[model samples]
Target: MRPDSCLSQVIGMTFDASVCDMFCAWGAGATLVVPARRELHRIVDYIVDRELSHWNSVPSALAIVEGLGQLVS
Candidate 1:
């Protein structure tokens, strides 16, 4: 799919220097959510609650989700 056509795609989790790529690569309608606090539980909660469409980050992030028993299948 052409990134230009992928509008309304939401992305922007962490700043690993790829945020720009995330927005440009995925097109518009994507807003980066920089958590007010760097709390693991809070972040995970949001991720699970919102059911964020796309999730891309380091392994540690996934580890926290698993540790909190939040990974859904």
Candidate 2:
């Protein structure tokens, strides 16, 4: 499926779902993944092991990702 389609599926998920750190990109729907904090590793692992994609964060978070080299693309 297209990236947008995958993102749409993610956004339709219920809030109670285990996923966290939802990022919405322009011209596309939301990309769901877990935050990268150590405490959130389990969730992050789950998303990464599943090979899911996510939108890049904005500003401060983006800087963090860049520093950590985890920025998508």
Q: What's the CA error at residue 39 for candidate 1, in Å? A: 5.5
TM-score of 2: 0.27
Best by TM-score: 1
Global local distance difference test of model 1: 0.50
The residue-by-residue lDDT of candidate 1 on 11-47, one tens digit each, is: 3445554555356544654543443444345655666
- The per-residue C-alpha lDDT of model 2 at residue 68 equals 68
**Per-residue lDDT for 52 in model 1?**
53
What's the C-alpha lDDT at position 28 in model 2? Answer: 50
Q: Kindly give the stretch of ten consecutive residues in candidate 1 with the minimal lDDT sum.
A: 1-10
lDDT for each residue of candidate 2 in 1-73, tens digit (9 for 90 to 100) = 2344322123223553323333333335434343335533343344556465643223454465457666467
Q: Compared to the true structure, candidate 1 yields what TM-score?
A: 0.48
List the global CA lDDT of all models: 0.50, 0.40
